[model samples]
Target: MMNHSMSAATNVMKTVIYIVCIFFAVLSIFPFWIMFMNATRGTFEIQQNSIAFFPSTHLISNFKILTGKSFNPLVGFMNSMLISSGATFCAVYFSSLTAFALVAYSWKMRQPFFTFIMAVLMIPAQVSGIGFYQFMYRIGWTNSLWPLILPAIASPAVVFFMRQYLLATLSLDVVNSARIDGSGEFATFNRIILPIMKPAMATQAIFSFVFSWNELFRPLILLTDNEKYTMPIMVSLLRGDIYKTEYGSVYLGLSLTVLPLFIIYFLLSKYIIEGVALGSIKE
Candidate 1:
């Protein structure tokens, strides 16, 4: 009788947990569903009723209105893709390399250097924006994507995360073994360490990509040409005037802008779970 009561209690607990999960899941997805539904409805319909439960037939019309504006979704998409991909690659690869150095070597200034990086991390990016913009302006890189892409190499946050991940997972015995086997440092890192760090790298890559894609401040301040504007910039521009704003078109642009983020998140989500789980375990 005790065992039966315990089993019943466990089953009831699981059912309650499942119900809570489903409720939160619906809450999470509700906004995106409304946004897509609004994207399909007419502007007047959206103004009349913002919370749309069903899709309408105004998708093509909304696209037409969105395209009538100065912004080109295709161009914005391409520019964002280029910047985000370059930034993600540089951030992940260089951060991983820096983390490897910090973990695998016994340099004298290792702790101090790591401390300096932590200091830099504490200093917010907005604090350095003016100095950064001035330097970029002096070098004539303000209008170019180079300013956005190259700065990612020194991402203190990514470096910090990678360092912690390496400390949790890296083994110095493996490094010594590779060194004894006549493997060059670069070769060992590229061939052995990178594969081991794949889960962490993928997780960080997703974050970096999403950050770059959604970035608006630097691009808005630096990019003078509409041709170089990212998706966020274009989407922001879609709201020209509050009174004349086409709600349907704006929602459509937002839905389009967010599509790639969803794709990136889905592609790398598995690695995120693995990276978090592995980072939590200490061997």
Candidate 2:
């Protein structure tokens, strides 16, 4: 009788947990559903009923309006793709290299260098925005994508995350073994360490990509030419004024802006799960 009651209580608890999970899942998906639905609706309809769940037949119309304005979806997509991809590559590769150096090499200044990186990470980007922009301007890099892409190499946050990941996952024995086998530092890093760090790299790649994709302030400040405008800037431009803002077109543009992020997340989501699982395991 006690066993049966315990079983029943366990079942009840699981059911409650499942219910809670489903509820939160729906809550998380609700905003994306509304945004996509609103992209298909007319501005008047959206303004009238903002919480609409049903999709409308005005998708083409919204697209037409978006294109009729200064927004070029294709150009914006290509530019954002280029910038974000470049930034992600620089951030992940360099950060991983830096972390590997900190972990694999025994140097006098290693801890101090890491502490400096942590110090930089604690400093917000906005704090140095003015100085960074001035430096870029002085270098004649303003209105260019170089400033946006190249600076990602020195990403303190990525460095910190990679260092922590390396600390947890990396084994110096492996490094020494590679050395004993006559593997060059770069060769071991590229061939062995990189493969071992794949899950963590993918996780950070997704984050860095999404961050660069959604970035606006830096691009807006550094770039003046419309040809260099990113997706976020294009979306911002869609809002002409309070009175003339086309809600449908703006939503459509926003939906387009967010599509790549969803694609990237889905592609790298498995790595995130793997990273979490790997981190949980004990030697």
Candidate 3:
């Protein structure tokens, strides 16, 4: 009788938990569903009915408006892809390398160097915005993608995350073994360390890619040409004037911008889950 009672209680608890999870999952997906629905709705329909769960019939019209004369979603998509991909690549690889150096090498000033990086991490990017822009301007990189792409190499946050991941996963004995085997430092890092860091790298790569893709301030500040504008900037431009603001088109643009991130997350979600689970256990 007691065993049956306990089994019934356990089933009840699981049912309650599943209900809560389903509720939260719906809540999380509600916004994206609304966005997609709004993308298909006309301006008047959107204005009349604020929260649409069902898609409307104006998708083609909205797309036409969004891709009309003023803004080109294709161009914005390409530019964002280039900048985000470049930044993510540099941020992950270089941060991993830096973290590896700090963790594996017992060199003089290593602690101080790590300390310096941590200190920089505490300093918000906005605080150094003026100086960075000035330096870029002086170097004649204004109106260039290089300014957006190159600074990612020194991402303090990525460095910190990589450091924690390396501390948790990397064994100095393995690194030393590779070195003792006469492997070149770069080769060892590229061939051995990189594969080991894949999960952590994938996790950070998603973050870095999303960040760069959605970033507007720096891109708006640095880029003068309309052709070089990122998706966020183009979306912002959708709200020029009250009369000109095609609400449906704006939502369509937003939906388009969000689509790539969804695809990317879907592709790398397994790694992200693994990284989180592994990192949490390590911690």
Clashing pairs in 3: none
Candidate 1 global lDDT: 0.87
Query: In model 3, what is the error at residue 190, expressed in angstroms?
Result: 1.7
Of 2 and 3, the candidate ranking higher by TM-score: 3
Model 3 is weakest, by summed lDDT over 10 consecutive residues, at 274-283
Model 2 TM: 0.84
Candidate 2, residue 6: lDDT: 100
Count of residue pairs whose backbone atoms collide, per candidate? 0, 0, 0
C-alpha local distance difference test of each model: 0.87, 0.87, 0.86
Off by over 4 Å in 3: 1-24, 242-245, 273-283
Error of 3 at 76 (Å): 0.9
- Taking the tens digit of each residue's C-alpha lDDT, what string does model 1 give over 1-283? 9999999999999999999999999999999999889999998898888998999999999999888877589989988999999999999999999999899999999999998997888676678788888988999987799888988999888888898888889989999999999999999999999999987887888778888998888888888788898998887787678426688888888899899877766777787677567545534
What are the candidates' C-alpha RMSDs? 3.2, 3.4, 3.0
User: What order do candidates take by TM-score, descending?
Assistant: 1, 3, 2
RMSD in Å for model 3 = 3.0
Q: Which portions of model 2 miss their true places by more than 4 Å?
A: 1-24, 242-245, 273-283
